[model samples]
Target: MARESFAIGTVRIRPGSARALELPITRLVTGADVTLPVRVVHGRDDGPTVWLDAAIHGDEVVGVDVIRQVMGSLDPKAFRGTLVAVPIVNVLGFMTGDRYLPDRRDLNRSFPGSARGSLAGRIAHLFMTEVVAKCEVGIDLHTGSDKRSNLPQVRADLDDPRTRELAEAFGAPVMLHAGIRDGSLRHAARERGAIVLVYEAGEPLRFDSYAVEAGVIGVRRVLATLGMTDEVSEPPARPSRECRSSGWVRARRTGILHLDARLGQEVADGERLGTLFDSFGKTLNAVYANRDGIVVGRTEAPLVNSGDAVVHIAS
Candidate 1:
């Protein structure tokens, strides 16, 4: 028998078909309805159901474009399984170019949300129910926040054999072992027996072509790896470095920052990575790497206060 239609929020999408939907969240102060936009592509063949979510933070928009490109390349008639995409999860914050919702809550930290809860909590709950609970695996796309740019990397609990395989197949430059944080979507999904990969790249509010391309290809490769699609790209020329641990190097002084290291640069312990400059051009303090590792992230803001995180190294 042919597969049954994929159902979400009372909408039934038949096999080899696709649909775009908006599930009502709430009404704005102006009385306009706020809703979550969802895209579903149901395949002709039976396969695992996977989801791709992005913009949980609103300003992290590279994933929005990534989803668009990836979906455009897929043919529901030839595809397998179902793909549920929530490209814009924080419409409220996204409209204002803010990271947090108007309620000042981080949407991502409000997972497994409630029916009778705060705005962020409600959205989280709806997503957990309507999207996550129905999928076997997913990719949570993100970008560096607060003016920092990241090298395209995958962060997950690499200890799991299957999870590790998926991360490796994604082929990001660095695969970091990161534990699930409380209230995070990853944590909630894991609790319910679903596996998720967090893909971090670029900086918020800007589209770096490389990061976008990397994410698009990575998603396609993962779909292929999961046996959900036949469109696959070759592995990245450089194998992804497996990072068991990573840390941030903070600024030692408040001043105009000048970073000497680039993303993915391998540096030794105590290497001078940058310098803090005073108005008169005098060096306020020279920043150095705290350990031997590859630079995966750094601040893009010109000024940072003392003890602010300046660079992230994965080793």
Candidate 2:
């Protein structure tokens, strides 16, 4: 009993089967072609089409492993729908371990890209057309940029009932109602009638075990909620601690920072988060919480400049 095959690019992924292929992006100066690697899993039964993408910003490598573990755990015969996994979106940046492309454009900011545009733009257009346009639901995985680390959290436009439902189903410790950014993948996907969730955790260029575990569990819960899979045995945890508003706490002075607060800790307004010190054991300034909220993100790097984002609090 052979199952049906699904078409993506020039390949046909047979149902109840999985395959790895490279979607052509562009060729390099040395006549080598750069391509985005994709893994497609077409299930035995019909269900909603869903996409899981990671590493739009090349430095955020946590999601790359997260997607890998996800694809490994899934069995096409048991799945109910199609699963499209793009582990690395920015191929050039991933190769160089840089956050942005060589063209100095942020790949995450180039969404629904143009064919006649820049490198990032072309990649964006290719992904939107070939991957996103085929899915009804999308989850864009991410990590905190620079030296910052984020608590396991789901950020989405919760106004839409379906989006909110999926966000809550993700079962992250915290869920933030973040507005759509211009030219973001979330925005582009939503424009095409897909409910997208931006899951953020850990720090760029580093892997956090807890964050990865949470992400794996959260994505599975979403799949169960969408009826795309029946393997989620454990029910999703209680509703995520919701935050409608959030803001960053900036450094008052440029110095070396000794952080006191940690991710997922509750801080009162005006509470001392950390202290900045000069080289001579002198206190340059003490950073305080500007709002009473949970610490959703914080800087892991010691060096800082004046007005640099030090902590992110969400209420």
Candidate 3:
């Protein structure tokens, strides 16, 4: 049987073809239209439909490059099933290099939204109905926020066998069994029976080469595992760590932050990770790990306020 056309908005791609389309969102005050850019690849053969999205937080640009790499290398004639990719989800924020929308709303926290709702809510609703609803699997790409840097990792529900299998196939440095957040895309998609994986790496607003390479490689690995395409399938240098719980180490005293701990370093409980120094170089307070865990994320800012999250440990 001939494959039917894959449609988004008013754009339709036939089997073994690809096309670029735009989803119109609200407009700016200058009367300019803000549209979400999308790419669709309809494979010649039938297989699982998968979606790749990024930059729900506009400051995170690594996923934008990752999506470009993945979509640029695909050959619809050799690929199987449909591939829906939205490289930049928050168009307005992306343009201004901000993390949230103009209304100061986090797009990630507004999902399964309504058509007549707020701007973020309406975009979420459009994405859910037009893109995610047609996909059997999804990979949401992200990076660390608020001057933090994250080691490349995949966060998902590891209890499910299939999701676990795919997470293993992704080949990130760590696989954390993370739970769902209210109004998150992961939560909404899972509720609709789609297997979702969230890939976190690098820092917001900058592209880390290592993190981007790992993400591209891991994404290709997942596609290969799903029989979508025979792309690169080499395993990572080391096996991914399976972490069940993780927490952030916060600053006890506001001061100039100095950290000696490195990403991927395994720290023992009670070990001093770093220290806080006053303006005159006096040690105000010391930071210590409360549990034995691997250092997966840490702040890059030189100064921190009291109770600010400084390091992220996963165990």
Candidate 4:
């Protein structure tokens, strides 16, 4: 079978191969060119086109490792369609070891952006035009923000059947039925009739081996589910659970926090999740769960202020 070709501006890509395309930039740094690196691998046969992107927040590098491992293991000859992998979308943020761009915009929150807007907006617009429009499905990878940690999980609106299926096939440790945020990649992809899954794991600026392995295997499972690759007879084990909703547990008073529970641990209503203590080791207050659920995320830093979110419980 003859392979199809992809043309994005002056860059031309042939099917059943991989290459890194440089996206032109103008706004992030004056006179400095920023490139959005993409790896396109199209199979020789017919199947669904899937886009796997990671590191939208530069510091969340777990997805980057996952994508790299998946890309390396895939055989184009065995694939049925195209797999576009963008390992690092926020080049500026990744370079500076930060989550947000130099302009202080959250790349994840700047989706379906404008070409004439800010740096993040333009990059988002470029991705929407060059990649999202050409793919049938997508998986956007992410992790917890600074000083926070998340268990391996998939966040999607389970109301959408396709999204639900992808989330399940991704095989994360948990699936959170999250609402779609405005200007998010998932929202933009859904608006364009493409089902996109958001996989969250580990923490920013650090790589968890378990999270990376899970993400890599999850991508492979999704590809197999989509008929892009053959299914493995024995896939890796996943430790995920489903949750209907999740919310943050905030600190009631300013003090140092000592967590009594860890991520993935179940908590009961009114159970002590943590304790706040004064500088002199005097107990100030005890933090309890208002509802029974699983601890999916929490702040790692011990310092806390009144109303600071210390933990996230999902039910």
- In order, what lDDT does every prediction score? 0.94, 0.93, 0.94, 0.86
RMSD of 1: 0.8
Clashing pairs in 2: none
Tens-place lDDT per residue, model 4, 207-232, is 88978988888888899999888895
Any idea how many clashes model 4 has?
A: 1
Q: How accurate is candidate 2 locally (lDDT)?
A: 0.93
Model 2: how far residue 17 lies from native, Å: 1.0
Give the per-residue lDDT digits (tens) of candidate 2, residues 26-89. Answer: 9989999999999998999998889999999989998998898989999898888899999999
Candidate 2 residues lying further than 4 Å off, grouped into runs, are 1-4
Query: Candidate 1: which stretches are off by over 4 Å?
Result: none
Tens digits of per-residue lDDT for model 1, 1-315? 899999999799999999999999999789999999999999999999999999999899999999999989889999999999999999999888899999999998899889999999999999999999999999999999999999999999899999999999899999999988989999999999888999999999998888999999999999999999884757778889998899999998999999998999999999999999988889899999999999999999888999999999998
Model 1 vs. true fold: TM: 0.99
Q: Please state the error at residue 152 of candidate 4 in Å.
A: 0.6
Judge candidate 4 at residue 140 and give its lDDT: 93
Error of 3 at 107 (Å): 0.7
Ranking by TM-score: 1, 3, 2, 4
